[model samples]
Target: MRLTVTFFTSMLSKVVNQINISADLNCGFELACQWRNNTAGEDSGDFLITSNVRVANHFNIIPSRNNSDELFAYTHGPFDGMQKATLISNTISCQLGGGTLTFWYYRTGDSATLEVCVRQPPGSLNTADLRCFPVFPKNYAHQWLFNAVEFPPLTQPFEVVFLV
Candidate 1:
C-alpha cells in the first residue's frame, strides 16, 4: 500500500505513539525515539527528531571531569549506595526534525534524578548554555526503565545533549 504524507495542521497536538530507549548503548548513553506521526493518522515509522547522542549528569554523584581531566567524563558509580552521573553530548547533526532524547537508566537511588539537555548551538562547551531539562529530581522505580522527551518539526539538524 502507498503511504500518503500530509502536513500536520497542529504541530503541538501531534500525539506521540511510542517512545523507546536503548539500555546497552555502546556509547554509554541511552537514546529516545518518539512516534508522533502515528498520532496524526500517519505512520512516520521511527521519524526521530533527535539522534542517538550523549547524556549529562550531576557533578556531586559523578565527577564532572574524567580521570584524564577531560570535560567529557565517565566514571562508574559507587558500589555501596546509589550513584548518579551526567553525560554530555557531541555535535548532533540532525537529519530530521522533532527528535527526542530517550534515556534508559538503572534506578540505583530511591530518589535519583537524571537530566537531558539540548543546546541551540550544539557543543558550545559552556555549561551555562541554553538547555532543556526533561526531569528534575525524577523518581524512578527499582528496575531498568525507559524515559523519553519529545520535540517537533523535523526540519533541520539539531544538537542532542543531556544532563543527569
Candidate 2:
C-alpha cells in the first residue's frame, strides 16, 4: 500500500501591537487578547483564562475565589445567574501613553449597557475624570470591541480600571 500526501500553501495575516508590563515582582506580562465590552450595560463572556474553557451551550460566568488575581465577569440566567467571577488583576497600572482600550466580550441578556472607563485613584468612579463608553448587546458569541481615546502622556503614576 502506498500513501501520498498533497502539499498546499496558504497565508494568514494579522496586525498586532506589542505591550510590555513590568511589576514589582520582577516579572512582566505580555498584553494579548482582543478587547470588547457591554453595549447595553448587562452582558458578559465566560472563558477560563488558563484552561481556555468556554461555556458553549449556555451563558454564565462562575465565581472563582481560587485565584488571587482573576477577572470578575457576570452573566444573566438560563445563561447562568449574575454572579461575580474573580477578574484577575483588578489593580492594573500602566505607563500613561496615547493608546486604545480593547477587550473581548459576550452579550447574552436583553438590551443593556456595557461600561468601560479610565478612572483616577482617590476619587469616586462617577467623577468627571472617568472616561466611560457604552456598548450594546446584540450577540452572544465571543466578540472583540475597541475604543480609541486620546490620552496624553502621563507625568505621574495612575491606575487603569475596566468595569462591566
Candidate 3:
C-alpha cells in the first residue's frame, strides 16, 4: 500500500492505462503508445498503446506509427472532425518525475490550434508558462510533422494533455 521511489538506484516508470480521445477526432490523426506498470504486470487489462482516433479517409493505417505504414494522410482544411475544444489524455498517475514527450502531428489550416499541456490537481503553484507545445499551428499542407517536447520536471501529480 506504500510506494517509494529513488533516483540513484531505481527508475520509476509511469503507467499509462488508457488513452481517451473525443469522438469527433479527425481520421487523419491518431495517437499510439506503449504503457506498462509493475503492478499491472503488462498482461491483464489494456496496457499497450493503440490508435483509435480517425477522420474518414484522411490517415495512413497500418498499426504502429514507426512501422511500415501507408506513409501519411491526405491533406485537409482543419480539425473540424473533432469538437471545438477536443481533449486527449491518458489514464495515468503523474505525481512524479516528468519525462520527455515526442510525437508526430500534421496540420494544414490556419487557427486550428494543437495544444500540449499538463494539468495538475487544484492548488498546485505550477503556472501556465511551464507548458509544452502550447500551440502547434498548422505548419504545412504536407506529411506528418515530427515534434519533441521537453519538460523541466514534475514534483506533484499531473496529467499530460493534447487539445485541439
Candidate 4:
C-alpha cells in the first residue's frame, strides 16, 4: 500500500519556548520524519521521510502543517503484499484530561489503508496489544484530509502508532 502521513499537534503552543527539548518530553509536539528515501539506497525501514510521492500519473506534494519542508511517507513497491509499514510517535505524557491527536493524510490507490493506534509500554508493537482508534479517513484520493482522535487521561506514558 502507498500512504502519506503528516502530523501536527495543537499543543505545540504550550511549549514553543522549549523547542530544543525532545518531543517525548513535550508530549504535544510536531512529528516530522527524519530524512530518508527508500529508493535512494537508504534503509527503507517501513516508512520514509519525504515531501512528495507519486502514484501512477498523479503527483502529490505534502506541505508540512508545522511549516516544515518534509513529511513522512510510505511508498508502494513491487514487493507490496500483506506487509505493513508503521510510523510510531514518541512517548506522550498527557495532562489530567488527555488530549486530541490531529493529522492530515493522503491516500491513493484502491488498496491503501491507514490506522491510528495507541499502545502502552511504549515499545511494544504486538498487534494484539494495540488499542486502535476508530478514526477513519475519507475515501477521497489525491487530496489531503484532516482527522482527529481524542484520547482519555493517561497516567502512564504511551505511544501513538500510525500503521499503513
Q: Which numbered prediction scores highest in TM-score against the true structure?
A: 4
Give the per-residue lDDT of model 1 (tens digit) for 103-160.
4444344333445556556435565665566553455443335566775543333344
> What lDDT tens digits, residue by residue, belong to model 2 across residues 17-65?
2224523211111222322222223334322233122444543332233
lDDT of each: 0.34, 0.33, 0.37, 0.51
lDDT of 3: 0.37
Write the candidate numbers in order of decreasing TM-score: 4, 3, 1, 2
Worst 10 residues of 4 by lDDT: 10-19
Model 4 vs. true fold: TM: 0.63
Better candidate by TM-score, 3 or 4: 4
Which stretches of model 4 miss by more than 4 angstroms? 1-45, 62-74, 77-81
lDDT of 3 by residue, 33-114 (tens): 3221224221121212223224345543232345443222222233454422322244434435445666565443445555
lDDT of 2 at 154: 51
Instruction: Sum up the clashes in candidate 4.
Output: 0
Candidate 3 segments exceeding 4 Å error: 1-82, 95-98, 122-132, 135-138
Q: TM-scores of the models, in the given order?
A: 0.41, 0.39, 0.45, 0.63
Candidate 3 local Cα displacement, residue 151, angstroms: 1.5
lDDT head-to-head 1 vs 3, winner: 3
Decoy 1 TM-score against native? 0.41
Q: Quick one: RMSD of model 3? A: 13.8
TM-score of 2: 0.39
Backbone clashes in model 3, listed as residue pairs: 26-54, 26-55, 27-54, 27-55
Task: Supply candidate 2's per-residue lDDT for 80.
Answer: 32
